[model samples]
Target: MVLQSNVRPGLTQGLIALMAAACGFAVANVYLNQTLLVDIAGTFGAAEAEAGIVTTLTQVGYALGNLLIVPLGDIFERRRLILALLGVVSLSLVSAALSGSLTWLIVSNFCLGLTTVIPQIIVPLAAGMADERNRGKVLGTVAIGLVCGILGARLVSGLVDSLWGWRSMYWISFGCMLLLALLIRLRFPVSKGTASLPYRRLLLSLGPLFMKEDVLRRSCLSQGMIFGSFSVFFTTIGFLLQAPPYSYSSAVVGLVGLVGIGGAIATPIIGRVIDRKGASFANKMCMLAALISFLIAVTAGHWLPALILAAFLLTVGTQANQVACQANIFSLSASARSRLNGLYMVCTFLGGALGSYLGVWAWTRWHWTGVCICGMVMIAAGMSAALGTKNGGNSHKR
Candidate 1:
């Protein structure tokens, strides 16, 4: 029988609330650029495809920050790092709000993404706090908030843009970051460990985990490919909806993301399945579900309800696989948890960053058919990666 870690810890309710708040606000930064891309393009006198870079550059910043900033949680006071990150994100949001040029807006957006590492920090922190038996459930709750923040950002940004303009979205984000920073500073516990390690070595050590560990490699690669597929759908859907007989407004296109609400709701259910049945089973199901969504997306053009259902299925796959990856990693070791999460997320975000650019480029050059094919191909790649790992045995191998 496996020895479960502490099933219950004496952590406070206040800390849990603060963690959820931090995740909610932090994830909003990743997607704030999505709903506003068209408006930003118009404001900057830029092409739509070029404006798509706003999302890509922000994700690029996130990928880099994951590599550089998240490992510091193991060596620094997690609370201090979290607060500082929120401060940087707030300032970046303000800069984005005040930008007079497209170049400046994109730069500020990149900074915002870099500093949004607050959620990443909080996830490891939450895992370190919860007991093994309750780990998936606790983390699932926070993950729910993270997914909600991501989904909600697009919805609110679009709705706000409809009412007050796109600039208002940044201003509102600035306020949310500011308030969450204060709450976190006052409520969350400070975590200080491994402070003696040199920062450079701390970052360098994560490389070996990939080289020696198959489970870690597969986890990172699976997430990377899954997110790549997700980015392909979202990045181009705006153009698709605005063009055809649908010809939806930015608000309508953004509202389409509400489909992810089902994924958020399914997190606890997926967590339970992983806790009882194991991650391998859960991972396989997620990969197959995502592949089906790709097929649905490819063949169901101009059918609003079918396309919406496909979007929901795609998000469900992404979130389930994400939960499996987290559970697999956190179950491995307590000491290296932060570094492990940092390494895994950097790869995943890099996948997302590539997908954003690739999706936009495909749409521009080859149209929606090309973009759909790209999404299908990425999902198939993810399924193949999952198949390669099925008989590898144990979540710790990768």
Candidate 2:
């Protein structure tokens, strides 16, 4: 097995910045629709429950793409593979732009999720491109872009849709994807993959690897639950904000994401603690913080200030938990980074998809409080798994 810092070539700042932009743009697709969910439902004359499928299916597609497309990074030339995926992503974005019906929009969004797996590919590429000295810095810079993309997409989409129309915003996204694809195809360096395994064998190895790696399993469980809890809130926050207690516009709903930037800023601080102490310590603290976030969010239905506080805590805790967990899991195998990432993302997003579906369901039945309870339950379940599992186990052999 090759170590990432040893075999993979380090990257330049210019390349890193480009990669950061690409990562943000790709990830923003899934999240851009969160604040726009209300307007979308209104457009199609659908219920909140039905419109929630947009987020749910998009997340499910992301999980599917992670499982299927991301593993190819280990099997193919990274640059060519990325460009190919970007081509398909561009097509999906264009399809989203042209969508006339809710079903069409939903289908287009799912495809967007599938092809937008580019960021996952890019992350391992960034890791491959960084040496020990700048590894964290490179990754952190790119990560901030991704965080901003996730939060900022809402504001852009909301403002665009409010000013122009929903279709126009998607058209803009479509053009951006096309432009990025062309630029990357021209500029990205060619890269050879390190893995020697055949396609079928590589795909088959994941289950056993999951069984064998305690760190991977524990991290997946902890991250899955935490991310699920996080998704539950995002999927339903629109519902809460659009109703009578607040009656905020979709544009106003999107502004709430600005609040999450406060959380994104805490990432470096969290990383420092992880370096000094351990990922386990950081995750435990995040779990407690998440619990508090959910508790605070219970009042968000009535109080906007409480809602802002809740969003900050949830984003901060979720970010730390994700970073800490990935650090633990990725430490297990450098050679298998792509496949390990595929598995990790699949687990995480499966939890996210489940949470999206159940969150809307809970909101339908019991409103905002139900969503808060779900978040707390996920935290409890994740903590239980973390406590029950052993740490520092052997890495898997393929």
Candidate 3:
């Protein structure tokens, strides 16, 4: 087995934990608006439809961050970039917590989304730090932290919103972001091997990546589809659970997201499998899990147990497939891994923006069935995209 040298010598596992936590906290900014949409709408005297725009704009901000901000990972020192973005996120959260109108809230959410690229930078950094023999494990560990952060955000946001008010969640996250930024600065070693490309070349090189690399293209598409489907579920679930048949509280609806932890836990295991046996087998199984989850969800009305199980399977499958896609991309490009990640995540977040809008539209039009159809079709589209690439092979640049 081949081993990759640690990017920095004398880096302790404790520092790695701190780095991953920073990424986790940073990424959690993206979803903080989702669980609180209703409360936010009422607070701002906006209609539910207008409040939905909060989610859309935040996703749009994330998409923009990926396209415009994350590419800088190749051109700048990663630690400085991470800390800078953390500062942006911290400030944005503070502003969001203080917003007096829907418009101001939306603007702040967009800023938060645009600046929250720390996870994207950190994930590739972690992969590069470990050798092929343990890359999957290292990625898995970081991914676990990220997954928990993503899920935990909803839980903490809900609990805090319940006690202090929804706005306080942002204030709390603001504090977390500040502490994380300081800890990362003091603890994590600087990445000595940061890509030294000029910004012009870094931006222009993405053109060939799209035109030439089938792996980059397909992986981006697959993640987009999976994330799109996932977005639809969470976006519209609030509407469903709050409607006539269920009428669950916001906290309970948030608890429902806890089911997604199954996927968080499954990510590293799937990473291990992708490490041993190529993604061929795992990809297909993940797709199957998504399809099955959709099938069960379509039939589950008033059957709370069935609906929760379906949600679990759907999240687990999507997250596992996402890890596989990232692992494959990392395997393909040693030098441009961060840019590759930036490209894929940008596309995925774009898809999520589209999905969240579509889910709300579908729910408004045809209710839960509409959202379910959106999920199934998107997942199917993702599966077809992955199938278009060679299953047992790797692509190389000339």
Candidate 4:
């Protein structure tokens, strides 16, 4: 077993927990608008199709931020950059809350997405600071916050919209962002190990880095596929739950986010596995679990418990696979940690967008069974890519 001592020692569980909470807080901004589209449309007197632009612009901003801003972590002081971005996020949220027109809301949401790269920065920082012995565990712990934010934002936004109206959600998140910025300034340690490369060079380096690294390429594709499949399930589950035998309400659909906790809780446990058995073990299980979950979901359409179990399994697999892939990615280039991470995120988000689009299309055409089939195919594709990489190993990186 080899341990890499890369950064100065100061990481603690308390700091880890705060970092996790901050990440959850920051990343939640991307999703807050998802559940509020209807109310927003009503308030602005916009059509449903026009209102959909809010989510579209948010997603675009997120992708652009991942590509453009995240790599700056390797150039600037990470904590300072984070604090600055938190300020941007706070301003964006407030602007969103006070938006007077659809156009203002759209631009504000885009800015909100652009600056919410804090979680991405924090993840690589956690990996860069920890040795292989504890890297997976730290990343996993932080992922709990990231994953929770990803799954829980819709619930929070939906609840707040019901209670006070859509704008209130932004106001709450806005206040929370300010508090997180303060706590981060006070508690998070400064880590700036990257060379003083020019910003253009820093950005340019990502291209060759992505093209040249076998491990990174593999990590991106494998996780991208799994996340794509994960997206498929979440994207279409509400439709399934609302129709036919289980005709549940939208609130009940929101409760389904709770099922995703299976993955959140399993993340650290999976990290332990990556530590003891290597990340490959977790990666393998990720593909397998995803494949199995889809099979179960396909047959269990009429049974609520079965569908819930399928959702749980799908989340566990995707989350575990992601943690393992990311643990490996962070190890690949200590100095390039943020760049690698940013690229990984960009790929996976693209995959998720693809899955969301495809899933909706499948549901529109063939309903539940079609959605399950599409998810299964994506997971299978990931598994196939993994198998072709090496003998007895898709996690050929570690």
In lDDT terms, how accurate is model 4?
A: 0.80
- lDDT of residue 381 for candidate 4: 77
For model 3, residues 120-190, the per-residue Cα lDDT tens digits are: 98888777777676566567667777777777777777677767788999999988888888888887667
- Per model, how many backbone clashes are there? 5, 2, 2, 0
Query: What overall lDDT, based on C-alpha atoms, would model 2 receive against the true structure?
Result: 0.79
Question: Model 1: which residue pairs collide?
Answer: 214-397, 214-398, 215-397, 215-398, 216-398
- Per TM-score, what order, best first? 1, 3, 2, 4
lDDT of 4 by residue, 240-309 (tens): 7666777765456667756777688989899888877777667778889889899999997668888888
TM-score against native, each model: 0.94, 0.92, 0.94, 0.89
Which residue segments of model 2 deviate by more than 4 Å? 1-9, 132-137, 388-398
TM-score of candidate 2 versus the correct structure, residues matched by position: 0.92
Candidate 1 on 137-202: residue-level lDDT in tens?
Answer: 767777787778877888888888878889999999888887887787777776786546789888
lDDT, candidates in the order shown: 0.81, 0.79, 0.80, 0.80
- Candidate 1, position 396, lDDT: 29
- Residue pairs of candidate 2 with colliding backbone atoms: 10-129, 11-129
For candidate 1, what is the total of clashing residue pairs?
A: 5
